[model samples]
Target: MNEQDVYDAIVTRRSTRNYKPTPVEPQKLARIIDAGRYAPSGGNSQTNRFFVVQKQEIIADLIKLVEEAFSKMDVYDGMYRSLRNSILRSKEGGYLFCYNAPVLVVVANKKDYGNNMADCAVAIENMMVEANALDLGSCWINQLRWLNEEPTLLEYMRKLGLPEDERVYGAAIFGYPATEDGKPNRVPLPRTGVDVVYL
Candidate 1:
């Protein structure tokens, strides 16, 4: 892909919170996961693991567990606003952080890896771009990563086959967008600056 294509993909990749009840096709989902796996890692370790979850019941159980986990935690100052919102919403009940998307891709990397979060975040961005290219809605879901080290959450994740030496660093929830016309919005907003400098 050229720079324009990449720019288009990045600009059009809006975070979708609302999703249709339909499931994402396995083939398309696989392509997105493949994009994630292709992301670069520190020292070419290539140890990032992408956990693709599609089972509805498992998703529901995870939602409940996540809500309960956040509900019991007291928010401290300087917490990310979104996470604080999640905690408050969970306390009030009914906070589906994933927005009931058909797929939740959890990116995990070795706990000892120095660039774990960086590599995992790149993978998630790749998956999100790929999902947008395939006309699917995608959003970054950070709650799992936030709770990745919690004892209860770690126990539950271990049951799901997360390696003992690995922890979630980022995640993406994806599905068909819940739009009236069944299409994800692709309008790009203006950007200020990334603080580039010319030689």
Candidate 2:
């Protein structure tokens, strides 16, 4: 790969909310997951666990459970905007957290690990970039991580193979874009907030 190709992938990757029901190709999916696995980890622990969910029934159940959990909670005045929206829509009935994507790669790590979230975040970013390179649409799903300790969600997660000592830190949902041309939008969103300092 050319040097500019990596930079291009990083710049053009965008959060994809709408996805087609079409399943991702097995080879492409494998390569994306591989990118995630190759991400750096604290002390080279490489302990992050990835759970790739592709079963429609299980995905539907997860959506229903997450919606039910969020709907039962009360929103506060200073809550984060995206989370607030989730709580509101969940109460309104249907709330597909994964946007109906065919594949949801749930990342988990030891709860007591100091760098769990950071490690998971790096992995997710790597996977997202790889997904974009493969012409797949991908989005980071945070609702599961927010409710990582909730009883109902924990129960379901355990059933799906999450160990007792592990908690979800992040997730990436992947699928083909719903666009007419079947290509993911690669237009880079303008940067207006990040500040850099020179030493």
Ten-residue segment with the worst summed lDDT in candidate 2? 182-191
In terms of lDDT, the poorest run of 10 residues in model 1 is 188-197
Q: Write the per-residue lDDT of candidate 2 for residues 121-195, one digit (tens) a residue.
A: 999999999999899999999999999999998999999999999999999999999999988899988889898
Off by over 4 Å in 2: none
- Candidate 2 clashes between residue pairs 3 or more apart in a chain or in different chains: none
lDDT of each: 0.90, 0.94
Top lDDT prediction, candidate number: 2
Query: What is the lDDT for 73 in model 2?
Result: 88
Question: Candidate 2, residue 88: CA error in Å?
Answer: 0.7
